[model samples]
Target: MRGLNKVTLIGNLGKDPEVQVLEGNVAVAKFSLATAETYRDKSGQPHTSTDWHSIVLWRGLAELAQAYLRKGSLIYLEGKLKARHYDDAAGVRHYVTEVVGEQLLLLDKKTGDALPPAT
Candidate 1:
C-alpha cells in the first residue's frame, strides 16, 4: 500500500522569513505561521486558539519568500510534513516537525507590493 504526507495551511506569518544559502548556493527560508480557530463552549462564550507551525521553503520558493513574505502576511501553503530529531550539545535529544512548502499563495497582497516573477 502507498501512503501520503501532505499539509495545507492558511495563516498569518509570525515573522519575516529567514533565508540562508546552503552549500551549493541553494536557498532555504524558514518562518513561523500562526493559525487561529474560534470555538464556542456550551455556555456560548467564544474562545480563540492559535497554533504556530514551522514552515520551510526551498530554491525558488525560498527566493520568493525573501522577496515578498513578511510578518503578519496572510498566505496559503501546501506542503509535506517532516519530522526529525537531533541531539544538542548537552547530548539531549530534541524533535522537530516542519512543513516543507511546495506551493504558496499570497493572500494579503496590497496594491503596491511587488508581485512574484512570471513563470
Candidate 2:
C-alpha cells in the first residue's frame, strides 16, 4: 500500500508571484497564498482564521503564474508538501515546508466592461 501526499487549496495570493531563473534557465515561481476559514465557536460566536501557505511552481506552471496572477488573485492550487532545509548566512539551519504546485487554476472572472485581450 502506498501513502498519499496531496494537498488542495483555494485561496487568494497575498503578493505578486516572484519568478526566478536558475542556472539551467529553469523558471521557478514563489508566492504566498492566504486561505481563510470562518466558523462559529462553541459560544455561538463567529471566528475567522487565515493561514498563509508558501506556494512554489516550476517550469510551465511557473510561467503561467508569472504571466497572469497578481496580488489578491483568487486561485485553486493542487500539489504536494515539500520540506527543504538550508543553512542561512548566520550558520543557522532553517527548515521550510511548502506546497510544490503541480496544478494551478485562475478563478478571476472578467467583467463585461473590461478591456479586450491584447492582440
Candidate 3:
C-alpha cells in the first residue's frame, strides 16, 4: 500500500517567478502564492486570512511560469508536497517544504495579463 502526497492550490502569486537553470540546462521556477479565506464569526463579523505557500515548477511547467506568471497573477495548480533538508554554510541544518507543481492553469483573464497555455 502506498501513501498519498498531493496538494491543490488556487491563489494569486505574491511575486514574479524566479527562474533558474541548472548545470544540465534544466529549468526550475520558484515563487510564493497567497491564498485567502473569509469566514463569518458568531457575532456576524466577517474575518479574512491569507496563507502563503512556496511553489516550485520544473522543466516545461517552469518555462511556462517564467513566460507568463507574475505578481498578482491568479493560478490553479496541482502537485505533490515535497520536503527537503540541507546544511547551511554555518553547518546548520535547514528544512523546507514546497509544492512541486505537476499541472498548472492560468486563471487570470487576458487583459493586460496574457494567459499562458496549460501545463
**Clashes within 3 Å, all models in order:** 0, 0, 0
Off by over 4 Å in 2: 111-119
Query: If both were scored by TM-score, which would come out higher, candidate 1 or candidate 2?
Result: 1
Residue 27 error for model 3, in Å?
A: 0.4
User: What's the TM-score of each model vs. the native?
Assistant: 0.93, 0.90, 0.92
Best by lDDT: 3
**lDDT for 30 (candidate 3):** 99
Ranked by lDDT from best down, the candidates are 3, 1, 2
Clashes of 3: 0
RMSD of model 1 against the true structure: 1.9
Q: Residues 5-113, candidate 2: write the lDDT tens digits.
A: 9999999999999999998999999999999999999999999999999999998888888888889988889999999999999999999999999888787786233
lDDT of 1 by residue, 12-106 (tens): 99999999999999999999999999999999999999999999999999998998899999988999999999999999999999999999988
lDDT of 3 by residue, 15-94 (tens): 99999999899999999999999999999999999999999999999999999898999999999999999999999999
